[model samples]
Target: MIDPKLASAAETFTLQCVINKRPVSVDVPPAKRLLCILREDLHLTGTKRSCDIGRCGACMVLVDGKPVNSCLTMAYQCQGKNITTIEGLAADGALNRVQKCFLEEGGYQCGYCTPGMIVTVTALLNKNPEPSMAEIEEALSGNLCRCTGYGGIIRSVLKAAEQGGRRHAGRHESA
Candidate 1:
């Protein structure tokens, strides 16, 4: 029932955005989800695609420094925005404090949800460097981790905060 020309136009738009500190340009359909673009097109598979419905928080990414569900975000809407994924959390081959703490604290199991969890926690720490236990729980409410029971994850976030995570809040690029 759609016009052919209109459909073609919608399928051929360009998206220009910075992802993981690198500028990328892709030609994609207007309705393409950012998750698909990141995983399928850009090959940034760090952003997992578990629940396509956006409830599981498996596709979380940072859009302009705010955490968002990439599965619910349209690729077209990402134009001119800066996106950060789990892969961007390191600098010059050094893991950020959050990531290091997660590993040291055993915050992940099976690793299916680690990337999204890390991304969401990173955003929370950036906004509130020293979030209380309730605040950390509230910020991570959307992200689910089945294997770790979340105790270790909470400890990891707390430990990262204690290690001056705020000092490196906005540093998502390699040095």
Candidate 2:
């Protein structure tokens, strides 16, 4: 029932990468998607999987401080990279400013797209603490949210900026 060539065990490779703030090692096939490696292999389910072809931002994750579609990234390519999933956004028990703003602004509804949206916004705000509406829209163009209607999400980003969240841009202040 299995294709011999595709299921060959000879291709397994040990991948070493930093995840969240910790280092992780995994044995995976070269072609295994980073999405599967994170969700299925590592059991970090906060990074959602939708539209595996990479059109949707549901699988977005921060790779070396930049937002990347995990579905489009290969496991081998992640070697020595710093990968941060949604679960990595918060430190200890407290949420980062971005996460707190999302909650206060009602940025999420179904929650499917929230992680990716937050990931993108985090990267954007880190790079530009005071981004304009146009810049925010352009940065979030890849993330699609069907439930929230974008109003709450926009407000969340704006609120995060207005609150002088630069102190907690990529990491919590206490972190």
State the lDDT of candidate 2 residue by residue for 62-96, as single tens digits: 99988999999998899999988888888776687
RMSD after CA superposition, every candidate: 2.9, 2.6
Best by TM-score: 2
Q: Tens digits of per-residue lDDT for model 1 on 145-168?
A: 988899999989999888865576
The CA lDDT at 159 in model 2 is: 98
Model 1, position 138, has a per-residue lDDT of 92
Best by lDDT: 2
* Regions of model 2 farther than 4 Å from truth: 1-10, 165-175
